[model samples]
Target: MPTTIRYSISDLATYFESTTYDRIMVLCDENTRTHCLPLLTKWIPHFQIIEIASGETHKNWETCMQIWEALVANHFTRNSLLINVGGGVITDMGGFAASVYKRGIKCIQIPTSLLAMVDASIGAKTGIDFQDIKNTLGTFYEAELTIIDPIFLQTLDKRQIISGFAEMLKHGLIADKAYFHQLLDYSFENTIDWPLLIQQSLHIKSSIVAQDPTEKGLRKTLNFGHTIGHAIESYYLEKENALLHGEAILYGMIAALFLSSKKFNYTSAFISALENFTEKHLSTAKIKIDITQVMKYIQQDKKNKGDQFLFVLLDAENQILYDIPCSQNEIIEALNYLHD
Candidate 1:
C-alpha cells in the first residue's frame, strides 16, 4: 500500500499516538538535529536520537553501520519505530537502515526540507551511496507514515531552496508541461505559494510511484534528469564543496532538455523558453568539473543495462520515454551541450 501522507500535525500526532512500538528512535543529522528536530519534538517527545554527520558524502555503508550499531546499542527490535527527520539523505539512509534492521521495522518520515517533502520522503525508495555511485545500495521500504510540513522550510537558505526547486521542476518536466511552465512563470524573489507547489510536485511523483513502485517501467520516468544528473552528483561528491543533489540535477535537467529538443521535434521557441528559464533560475554554469570524469561516472550508473546506457527522455508531446538507449557519443554530446 502507498504510505499515508499527512500535511497536518494533528494527523501525525494521532497516528503516532495510536501506533504501538517496543521503542522509538528519531534518526537525524547534525543540521536537522539543530534546526528541524525541535519542531518534531512537540508531537513526538519520547524517542532516542541517532545523529549522524550531514551531507551526501556521509550517506554510505560506514554511516549505515553507524546507524545499525546505534540501533543495536539501543536494543531496537522489529517492533521499534524509527522516525526519519531531515532532508533526502536522512530519509533515504534512515529508511534503508530501518528496513534492514531485524529484517524490517516500522518507520515514520518527517521530511524537513523542500526536496524531501516533495520527493525523497514520499516514495518508498530508500538508498545510500556505495563506492561513489548515487543510491547504489538501498531498498523499497515504505514508511508507516510520511508527514510533510512546510514549516521546516524556513530553515533553508536560498541555495537550498533552489536546490529543492530543481526536483519540483523535474516533476513538471516529466509529467505535466503546464506545471513546468507554471513553475517557470513564478519568481523566486517574491513570495511563493509553497503549499500549492509542494502539493503539485508530490502529486506528480506519488502518482507515478503508485503505478510502478519497483521502477518496473513507468516509474523510471521520474528519473528524467537523473541519468546524467547522478553522474555530475557523484563527480562532485568527493570535492571539498560538493554540489547539492538538486544543484547537480539542475545541470542534468538542462542537459536532458537539450537532448529532448534534439531527439524530439520541439519548437525552437519552446526550447528557447526552457533555456532562458533555466539560466535565470537554476543555472549551474559557474560550477565547473572535468566532463571526462563525469562521463566515467555516467558509465558506472546503476540504471545502465550491461554496456547500454539507458535514459528517460521526452518525446515531442512532452511525454515520457523510458529505457531509451543512447550511445556514448550521444551521451557525451548531451553533456557537452551543457557547456554550450
Candidate 2:
C-alpha cells in the first residue's frame, strides 16, 4: 500500500490518538529540534528526542550509528515508533535507520523543509551517504505516514527555501508542462502560495512513484537532472564551499537542457526563458568546471549501466527520455556550458 500523507499538523495529532506504540522517538537535527520540534511536541508530548548535527556532511554511517545507539540505549523495540522531523537528510537517514533496526520498525516522516515536503519525504527512498557517495547506502523503506506542514517552511531562510524549490522545478519539467510554466512565474521576492504549489509538486512526484516504485522504468524520468547533478554535488562534497544538492541540480538541468537541444531540438525560446528564470531566481555564483573529477563521480553514478554513460534528457516537447546515452564530448560540452 502507498504511504499515508497528512497535510496539516492537526492531522498528525489526530492520528496519534488511534495509534499505539511501546516507545516513541523523534529523530531530528539540532536546527529542526530548535525550530520544528516545539510545534510537534505540543500535539505528541511523550516521545524522546534524538538530535544530530545538521547538514549533508553529517548524513553518513557515523550519524546512523548515533541514532542506532540512541535507539538501543532507549530500548526501542520493533514495535516502537521513530518519527523523523527535518529536511531530506533527516527523513532519508531516519527512515533507513528505522527500517534496519531490529529487522524493521514503524517510522513516520514529518518533513520540515520545502525540499523534503515536496520530494524527499514523499518518496519511499531512504538512504545515507557512504564513503562520500550520495545515498550510497539505502533501503526501499516506506514510512507509516509522512506529515507535511507548510508552517515549518517559515523557519527556513531564502537559500534553503530556494534549494528545495529546485526539486519542484524538476518535477514540473519532467511530468507536467503546465506546472513547469506555472512555476516559471514564481518569484521568491513576491508573496507565494505555498500550499497549492506544494500540493501540485507532491502530486506529480507521488503519481510517478506510484507507477514505478522501484524505478524500473517511468520513475527514471524523475532523475532528469540528477545524473550530472549528483556528480557535481559529489565533486563539491569535500570542499569548504560545498554546493547544496538543489543548487548543483540547477546546473545539471542547464547542462541537460543543452544535451536535449542537441538530441531533440529543444527550442531556443524555451532555453532563453529558462536562462532568464535562472538569472532572476538563482544566485550569480558560478562553479568552475573540473570535468576530470566530475566525470569520475559521474562514472560512479548508480544510473550507469556497465561503462556506458546514460542520462535522462528532455525532448522538443518537454517530455522526459530516460537512459539516453551521450558521448564523453557531449557530456563535457554540457558541463562547459555551465562555465560560460
Q: Best lDDT goes to which candidate?
A: 2
Q: How many clashes (backbone N, Cα, C below 3 Å) per candidate?
A: 0, 0
Candidate 1 lDDT (Cα, whole model)?
A: 0.85
C-alpha lDDT of residue 48 in model 2 = 96
For model 2, give the 10-residue run with minimal summed lDDT. 278-287
Q: What does the lDDT read for residue 150 in candidate 2?
A: 96
lDDT scores in order: 0.85, 0.88
Best-fitting candidate, scored by TM-score = 2
Give the per-residue lDDT digits (tens) of candidate 1, residues 141-256: 99899999898888888788878888988888888888988988888778899899999999999899988889999999988889898998898888887888888888887777
The pairs that clash in candidate 1 are none
Candidate 2 runs further than 4 Å off: none
How close to the true structure is residue 21 of candidate 1, measured as C-alpha lDDT?
A: 82
